[model samples]
Target: MGNCIICGKPVDGLVCESHQEDVVFEFDGNSPSQLTPDRYYRGTVDGYADFGVFVDIGDHVTGLLHRSELDRRLESLDWEPGDTVYVQVLDVRDNGNVDLGWSIRQTERDFRGKLIDAPDGEHHPEDVETNDDEGSASAGAAADEAEPSGADDETSSADDATPSADATVPNGRGAHAATAEPEPVEESLAEETEGGLNRTTVDSIGEQVGSVVHLEGEITSVRQTSGPTIFELRDETATVECAAFEEAGVRAYPDVDVDDVVALQGEVERRHGELQVETEALEILAGDERDAVADRLEEALEQEAAPTSVDLLADHDAVSAVRDELVDAATVIRRAVMETRPIIVRHSATADGYVAGAAIERAVLPLVREKHTRDDAEYHYFERRPLDGRVYDMDAATGDVTSMLEARDRHGEQLPLVVLVDAGSTAESADGYELLAHYGAESLVIDDSRTDEEIVDAVAVAVAPSLAGADVDDVTSSALAANVAAHVNDDVRDDLVHLPAVSYWEDTPEAYADLATEAGYDETGVSERREAVALEAYYQSYKDKRELVTDLLFGDGEATRAQDGNLAAHVSGQFRDKLETELETATENLESRDAGGAEVTVLDTAAFTHRFDFPTTDLLLDELHRRRDAAFTLGVDEDELRVRASDGIDVRELGEAIREAVPDGGVHVVGGRDGHVEFLQGEREAVREAALEALEELTA
Candidate 1:
């Protein structure tokens, strides 16, 4: 019998049954079966799994602290591998697996005393340190030989590494410090032993120039230079470009590709203000080594890519209806950025699409610059290509596939995440979406158009308010894009607050208009930006124009600065002049007729307006429709039919009626958020007559 450490009570060992909970046990046993249940044990984090954390209680014994046993969120714990933590031994199963539970007492100071739970017997923890110290003296000497003779600094560093004893126990019951494997060095740390070099992180190699160092990380990207194969290695701290050379214009480490967890030994060199590794040896890690690095990066990326709690910029009901869907889309986009997968935005060629796509670009560019070590990473990682129309057709999909496949073959980039903004919510784009999917690419759609139910299965995330049975007429695609952008990156939330309003043409939401006004843009400012983007969208309808678009929609209005808002006004003047001239001609060429009792005015857009000019066919049509005095307005291009009314037009019903009348014309609703009907050019006259008859019957 003995007395408890905390109380004056009798017990079989050092602590009584009631006082057992007051003590922390240092587990030195070789088997999980030897651990006592319901006692707190000191454990080192071995590695992380999706379900739980593996904690090493002894040299051979490991316990799983399931995520359910954690006091807080598993990802929020901030515990890294090899970190010493405290837990309770909940049970030791017959299969030799140990189950651990959360312990309220994490620090040694919280316990009354520390006991060593050995296989033979239990004893005071202080007694084992004398033996541990003598056992580590040989490793201490080995470490001293590998490093400079700063004996005190070397010993303290060695002391810090002592807790994480090798789980393999290769030395057979060795000292903790002697069996401990050092983690990858975080900063300017250099170590050379008689056996080989120690591990150094990519971030630490900046100062270790001209010296051979070892690195352990996942390869985020790879590029073939003329003289060498450049591999971008990313560790917890940062990514460095590693160049491995077999011969000039030849592939080095041919089997190694992106996302491979690797251990690379190379000499660090400074090239063009960036560090590059000239590889000496490379090994693809497997088993525990790969799992450890993968887990670390997975956790890091998950934390970085997790969406911030950003409330919707405005209280618009349509946007509020699908808030969760917005979050899902944003999370997908942010994760793609973190994983170094390129983002290809395919948006409709319009003022709304430009603003929608630009909002995401503005939020994501800064993150791309921050995540990648290379200066040109933003341009390479993010791209925005405008669609000729609102549909993601085969031509666009084929072009995207060719470029992405070529990149994967040549530079070793992962397949991109295609973001369809203001488009691709209908059956028209399903073939294109499926083509991308076959090539292992995922897509996210944020459109305000009426969604086809079948499209839900085709995309990774779909954020269409119409899916939730809400009217999306007043909800511009830019509102959805900007909201998604805010969630993707919270740092640019201030820059995005006003963008939702700038996308609106006529019925600017009072709340959104107020938001724009607060962000230094009034009604006139919003109009000018909208007009400028509309004008520019026509010029290069296929390019991102990142900087120029950023300046126009999100310009800082300081008068001294000569770009941004100043530039918006300059371009908008041209827009106003060109639009006025086109509108005047379009109005002069209008022909009116009585259909039933309603007056329908028709403008032959192909004959009167410039085929390729500042005011695009759609823009000219919208302006004429807005200025029309008649009850209904129709604009006819070569093979296209456009319709507009004060209230919404049911293009589907009208198209059905017209198609019945002109079955030989091959007339169909091919495009537009509301509706745009198209026909075979050779049968334009018959299609137009059928559309006029359909309008008369519908109005009757």
Candidate 2:
């Protein structure tokens, strides 16, 4: 029996049951079943497979370290055959398959205590009998005589009875430090070793520059430059780049990888005003020591990266139903930022979509800045793309996959988190979501549109009122995204409060409107910003134009004043003029007809209006729908059709009828319930006649 080293409790070994996981054990057993489960063991890297690594624990037992247990990608592992590694014995199945888990600690010295687990039972190193008692007694006498004056004789004797700090044993190498009198080798091997290394955190690394230091952290990333392999290490406090050079254009420390916990011993140096470590030696930590490091990091991350509990920004019941989803979405985005994963936001090219995308961008940029020490992290981390249509089609998915794959190969970047704002809710986007999923990329959809139920299975997180059994009309995409953004980073919640109001063209929710009003954005200001964003969204539909959009929406009084001809006023005027002019021409060209019981207004958009004008066909259709008093309005260009009707009309049903009536017209519901359709130019007249007939049937 012995006293526990950590808690000072009586035990059969150096540690007690509660602290058993605190120490790493070296397995001496010959078979898999002899190995104790839940205990970390030092193992040898036997080989590798596509799925995981094979490790040999002892002469007769081998275990499989599956890749799923790894914290990072499998391709990033640098382990080689014959390298000593630390792993935890997770299980020994009935078939004698020993399942292993990766350990963060690599060296025996990092562990608090060591044990030899044999087929018979667990045995401490001190339990082994030796014939060096006379030598041990002489060493104890020498240690006691050299003790400090204030130390009690009993304490001195106790300290002398234990191992000396410098005593060596089998440490992979058989070399031992010779002394006149040596302590017991088993006790020496069981004790932890620091070896005069200055252990420090990454945040305090600045003070240790020009000095050799030891830091324990998880490798966030590894980039191989022409000269050195740069391993980006992040502890709880901060992240730093450690450069290990074998030679020019050669790899260094080939066994290390991103997410591998390692004890790094190096000299801190300043390169280009950034702190980097010039690695002298890097060791991957494993066993109980590794578990402790991982546990510490996990605890720190839980404390720092967890999203704050959201207080409902709006008090609507519709918003309350999916409050958990909103928080989850926010947390996912935040966690992605901390993990250095790039975020790609795909939103519809509409006012509501732009507002929603911009709100997330605003919330995420500050976090990117705060999390990464790199100057260009904002650009490297976040990207916002405006989709040409509401659906995230195969075309869009292909483009995203192509670009992200290129980035991965060229820059060694992780695949981005694809965030769909005000888009990707319908079944039409399923193909796109699947493409992303096939590549192992994560996706999120936050929309207020009526979505198909199948979309729930296609995405990691889907936050839509329709999916939550709430009325889709009760909330706006901007409001949902704004609430999510507020929770993503609460510091910018006030900045995003005005966004939901700006998204509404009419009947802005009183709760969100009041929020905007309190934030000094009145109805007129909101309208101007909305109109301006819509106009600008057309010019360069692909680019996010983040700064320009920010200036247009949240610019101060001086920015809005006409003295400088602010972007908001200029674009808003353009929007009004273009929309009004289109409305005038459409009104003059309107052909009124009675279809069944409802009044229908049909405008030949190709002949009467400018097709290639500032206001798009969809925008013009929207304006005409709002101004006209008919039960249903239909706009037809040469080959395209746009329809708007009261809530009583089923656009999908109308579309189906139109397809049946005009077989070769290629009629389908293009927009989700918006009633847009397209046809071959040859079938325009037939399509128009068919649409009129279908409308009459629907109104009946």
Best-fitting candidate, measured by lDDT? 1
Q: Give the whole-model CA lDDT for all candidates, comma-separated.
A: 0.78, 0.76
Cα-lDDT of candidate 2: 0.76
* Per-residue lDDT over 215-303 for candidate 1, one digit per residue giving the tens place of the 0 to 100 score: 88888777764335678888766677777655333578788889899888766766545566767566777888789878988898778
Q: List the residue pairs that clash in candidate 1.
A: none
Error of 1 at 206 (Å): 5.1
RMSD of each: 23.0, 19.2
Q: Estimate each model's TM-score.
A: 0.70, 0.69
TM-score of 1: 0.70
**Prediction 2 TM-score vs. true:** 0.69
For all candidates, the clash counts are 0, 8
